[model samples]
Target: MLNLNDLRFFVQAVDCGGFTAAGRRLGAPKTTVSKRVAELETALGARLIHRTSRSFTLTEVGRDFYDHARAALIEAETAEAMVRRRQAEPSGTLRLTASVPTAQLYLADHLPALAEAYPKLHLVVEVTDRFVDLVQEGFDIALRSHFAPLPDSQLLQRPLAREDIVLIAAPAYLEKHGTPQWPQDLAVHAGLLTGPGATTWRLGGGDADEAVEVTPRPRMLADESVVLLKAAAAGLGITCLPEAMCRDELARGAVVRVLPGWTAGSVTTTLLMPHRRGQLPAVRAVVDFLCARLAR
Candidate 1:
């Protein structure tokens, strides 16, 4: 007796922010979409949304029902996908997030192939430095780079890469300031530091690789590491950067390594997903694609 089509209309209406928008997306008339959602409300015997002349708001019960409704739709889609996947390619919109630097330096390069391989698949990427609640925010996946192990969470964590951090400065910068020969030599030099800023920078030294922490006087600071990369390349100051990102620059002599024996830091990039949603074909393809590409 449950009308899943009506349920779809209701969910799409909420997602699109209005029945008219949902109808546009669904290739149906606005009146039809609105009526379908109304029939769904009648079946449930609850006022799911409060409609206004220019807008609509989900009722308290509607908010809770919307969450369940989305999950049910996903389940239904997954069941059909299980059959189609054997003969067809994955196709759907996948919403994902990544830090600013990761998006620029890493993910942007890897995504093109996903598009090329799955022409029907659509990707929505959010480039941000802040951690987002995957379920609450409706993101399919998140790529994060962190120093410490991820905190306790229900989200499934997949380790991607542990990249070494290196010290880099433009040839012009060293020409002006002179090259630093030792870890302590960095004290007098300018630093293009990343945020949340580090009070003291830790450097590795000696054959046994002992740790040395130095307080950097920042010439410039930014929340994103890519910003510092630009600043460093412009001869603004020295900064810590992932070695993998420095490959092309290091090869072309655009930037030179400082204090060869010492390292600035390291980072681990991880993929996070909400529960069983990772099993969906489109989501799984992205996960697999990123894992394989980022590994290189």
Candidate 2:
């Protein structure tokens, strides 16, 4: 006979990456979680994971079992939720992840109101710019800005906003170097590109696209988008930033938009959720709130 409790622990362990992390998440001792998973494997007569010192990766059979187990567990929880919903109450901890700027300015700004609306919903937010593994991070939902839908099989995403990009340069830099008159002129001017890829930039003009390869003239290169913004603010070079991120700076004359008519619309913010059936009320409520807020 298979133990449902042990199956739950196995799912959590896989999601969390290691026994220690899974123990912390499940509030159980490492030995206990490890024993349960081991026992499960013994009963199933298959190796579920390939374990190493650094990480534990799922085997082919393990991956297949995890999918079915996750679905079955979620369905069981949903059945319980239906019973709880009959009593009319929403109570659970919601784990959410988002980039620093969006969490600080957009998500956290509106959360107080949502908390007021639903006092039972507890919000735990992880702010990071790095792409987090939803399952391994133990996040119920994440806010991401992607050019398209997420590629992960265990995640589902919904669109939230169509954010546009803008080219920004410090006023002094613009004055010294002179702003580019046309999209093609961007090639000559120094640029502070955000992420490394082929050292090429595509500037959008009305019904036309201009491709420019900008090689910065020996300056500090940063991987963080915020770093590029700060560098641009320090009059380093011209940088492309999301319009929403630099709106205040542009309004305050801290940074000026170089190409007004031309824009490369690439970024988009979306809400990503685990592909679980029994989503806690807190998670659903927050997702709904964000969609409504962004749509408005």
State each model's CA lDDT, in order. Answer: 0.85, 0.78
76 in model 1: Cα distance from truth in Å?
A: 0.5
| Residue-by-residue lDDT tens digits, candidate 2, 1-78 | 788888999999988878998999899999999999999999999999888787799999999999888777877777
Per-residue lDDT over 8-97 for candidate 1, one digit per residue giving the tens place of the 0 to 100 score: 999989988898889888999999998999899889999999998977999999999998998888898789878878878988789999
Candidate number with greatest lDDT: 1
**Winning model by TM-score:** 2
Q: List candidate 2 stretches off by more than 4 Å.
A: 1-3, 16-21, 34-65, 195-199, 207-220, 277-279
Q: How accurate is candidate 1 locally (lDDT)?
A: 0.85
RMSD of 2: 3.8
